[model samples]
Target: MFSLSSSADAQVEPFKGERIDPDVTSGHLNHLTPDQQAAFNVFKDTLAKAQLYSPERPHPTHDEPTLLRFLRARRFDPQKAYKQFADAEAWRKKHNVDALYATFPVDEFERARRFYPRWTGRRDKNGLPVYVYRIASLSGPLQKELNTIPPERRYQRIVALYETMTRFVLRLCTHLPHRTEPTPISSVTTIIDLDQVSLPTLWQLRSHLQEASALATANYPETLSTIAVVNSPSFFPTVWSWIKPWFDEGTRRKVHVLGKDPGPTLRTLIDPKDLPKPYGGELDWKFEDEPALDDAAKAVISEMPKGPVVFENGEVRRPTPPDPADVSSGES
Candidate 1:
């Protein structure tokens, strides 16, 4: 590995994690007082000694602001944080996260985006990547493709996609300009638009939502700073009630339920200039834009490869015929 010169190191700014001050206004440990930092160190050291520790595993340094993200999520309770850290480490191994990251499934992500429409777009006011999931707009051939997967396999694939995509987004955060260590960048601000969601749609998603909540809370741990559920319908309270128990106190508190006009809440958390047009923000960025989905995703639904075919202008078009040579060679 190449080493940074002393001159290069000197230019590196001291992040909140490197300071003992409680007055730091930004970054991962911004909320941590000097006393809290001291207490957290004990927990961090304990976690490092746990059986799940792997020397080769990629993680932020012990003193890095990112490490404190998990600790802070557990309210600086070392034992609880250790369980989260250890479990996450084990889950990564079991899921072969390293391999997944190295070889990202571009086509699969393209397919998944059609169904989920969740994407990491521009940074929020705090510089956290904005995660938007248009829950009400689950259409296209990808929906059929996702449904075709057996429940058990679907669960695994969904979990893998969730974790993998999260890591990918966080990785992208590292490259954003004007970023400081830890604090906001370590967490994401999410908007789950529930407009047009029917009862049947809610029922179909119940299991996947449950598994996703459990996986995120247990494994990802404190990765979400905010979850603004906008455009919530009358039935949303019932749906929220069913899923509310899945979240921990910290997570539940982060969730903000809003009605059709979520502009005010979104404006308070995000700069109006950074907000999407639908949410009363000025950002020209649209969910269907490829940039919003990042490099891992393909073009918008219409331009994507046709598997089961998609509804175009309110009509379902016939699927394109498979390539004869590809079929003969048994290629996907």
Candidate 2:
């Protein structure tokens, strides 16, 4: 393969694995400095006082961890964080988000999953879940299929996928029995392939894309570990200008814009076996094919603890961490 020019190299920003100052990325429950600890205690108290949260929440993705996510997204300012927290709780109830995943039709869920980034069923070098999006493939049937769905259903697809990632994938990966990594795998590592995304396809996806971006930024808050944008065309800068405003600064910092060639940079963060073939790895998977399960995912089914998670919307989730050790490494 021929080498790319220095001009091309200039666009290739590498992934930095940044943590928000005061180190909130090291999971939400612990490792906060004394000052941070006090702020969290106050944050919890504020939620309790408002009665938005009755018992505060648990580690990983529940009330406790969610408080930390909101706090960090708001730059540790308790007041702004409180408003966001209040709004999110209200939004969840209004949308029935807690049970949206459980009751979302299996047929619809399977169909919708194809529209967004498909999880690789593997983890990155740091053991965070890995996802690959073949955006160039979003034309013809993919575009037509997506457009045909009712507007309400399309929006529900977004919420359902987010809920699945937060409640299901994060829970399993965080608790895998043999994982030696001390940090709970609360976030994800993403590879966004924009090799040949046409102008028409981009135009078509703009609304759904922007809405999903806004939703994640508002409610999910700080869940992205790293996003490596690969195989981008020369026009990417213009496209990015339109899309960049959707994410907050913290989220933007996690994006690595790798122009045209992505192999070298990708190898630095993801191993060959774990990464998919399209991204220059040996996994032997494709965008439309069934996802291949890695050992860790298989272990989730066979080795991890299980629990009955009954949502307020009357739907139940599986394996809701019996204890901290079950989901976290007990390091923090």
The candidate scoring highest on lDDT is 2
Q: All models: lDDT?
A: 0.55, 0.65
lDDT of 1 by residue, 1-332 (tens): 00001111111221112111111233255666776777677876786576343233363323244466667767777788787777776675566544443344556545555454354456666566676777656544545566787876555555545543444455445444434544435666777777788877877767656766676666656567666666767776566556656665555555555667777667766777768888878877665554343222222222322222322233334323445574455332
Q: Can you give the TM-score per candidate against the true fold?
A: 0.71, 0.81
List runs of model 2 lying over 4 Å from the truth.
Answer: 1-27, 56-63, 177-182, 302-332
* Alpha-carbon shift of residue 286 in model 1 (angstroms): 3.5
Per-residue lDDT of model 2, residues 261-319, tens digit only: 56666776777897787777888888775557687566445322222222222222442
The TM-score between candidate 1 and the true structure equals 0.71
Residue pairs clashing, model 1: 27-183, 28-182, 28-183
Model 1 misplacement above 4 A: 1-27, 51-66, 139-142, 163-166, 178-184, 293-332
What is the TM-score (0 to 1) of candidate 2? 0.81
